[model samples]
Target: MLAVELNGDAVRAKNGSMVAYDGRMGFKRLTGGGEGLRGMVTRRVTGEHMTVMEVKGQGTCYFADRASNINLVRLGGEKLYVEASNLLCTEEGLRTGTTFTGLRGAAEGNGLFTTTVHGTGWAALMSDGPAVILRVAPGLPLTVDPGAYVAHTGELKQQFVSGVTWRTAIGEGSGEGVQLRFEGSGTVYVQPSERTTLGGQL
Candidate 1:
């Protein structure tokens, strides 16, 4: 569970993720994650959906989702690519959008579009287990299992790398088969426990 204190400020959270609250707090279910009509249309067209609620007023609010471990990311004018289901909460100033992730998103069965949170604020991400933060630089790139990816921030170029071979047809393939390679400068959050993905079985 994550607890955030606000003094006349607001936070956008995953709808129905609030566990508790104290003092004067107002909860409003946001249409299209508070992006209004255009965002609603975009989300409907892209099939990347998020139900968000805005919590405001002076008090402390607690948030949780499926008892997953929560990781807090602080952004300073950088873009964060995350799955809609893994996103927990964000400060009101941050803007949320969607972008195509190509094969990487398909590997996880999460469609081709992924949620993007950009601007300067704090956002909370949830994972099945404790998430490891990996750094990627110009010389050093990070390749991640699609099932383990939770979120990432900074300027990163993602490439789909497959380890499938003739052996894969005979059920003798590496469990870590397909991966998403992240190059450039950024930080990636990966969970210790992998989610069940189509790539994991392939």
Candidate 2:
């Protein structure tokens, strides 16, 4: 469960995620994840669907979804790239949109576009377990399994790497056949457990 304290401020959260609240609070369903008509149209066209609600007023609100573990991320004028299903909540000042992720998204079975959040504020992400934060530097790159990926922050370049060979295709190779390679300066969030991704079945 995640607790958010609002003092005359508003926050955007996943619709139907609120479990409890105290004091005066208003919950309004946001059309198109609160990005307005263009954003709604973009989401529809990209296949990255997100249903959001705006929570406002002075009070503490609680949120939970499928009993998933929640991770809080503080952003200071940086962009966050995350899956729509993994994102839980964000401060009202943040801007939500979609970006092309190429083959990485296809490996996860989430399509070619992923959700993006920008601005200075806090956002919450959901994971199968407590998320692990990995740092990437100039020379030190990081590779992650598609099923365990949660979200990433900062400027990072991502590449889809396939270790699949003829042996793998014939079921005589390592299970770790595909991966997402990340380089540059950034931080990645991964879960301890892997989800049922297309890459995981390979």
TM-score winner among the candidates?
2
Q: Write the per-residue lDDT of candidate 1 for residues 48-74, one digit (tens) a residue.
A: 999999999998999999999999999
Regions of candidate 2 where Cα sits further than 4 Å from its true position: none
TM-score for all predictions?
0.98, 0.98
**Poorest stretch of ten by lDDT in candidate 2:** 168-177
lDDT of 2 by residue, 11-113 (tens): 9999999999998999999999999899999999999999999999998999999999999999999999999999999998899999999999999999999
> Which portions of model 1 show Cα errors greater than 4 Å?
none
Mind sharing the TM-score for model 2? 0.98
Candidate 2: residue pairs that collide: none
| Local distance difference test scores for all models | 0.94, 0.94
Report the CA-based lDDT of candidate 2 relative to the real structure: 0.94
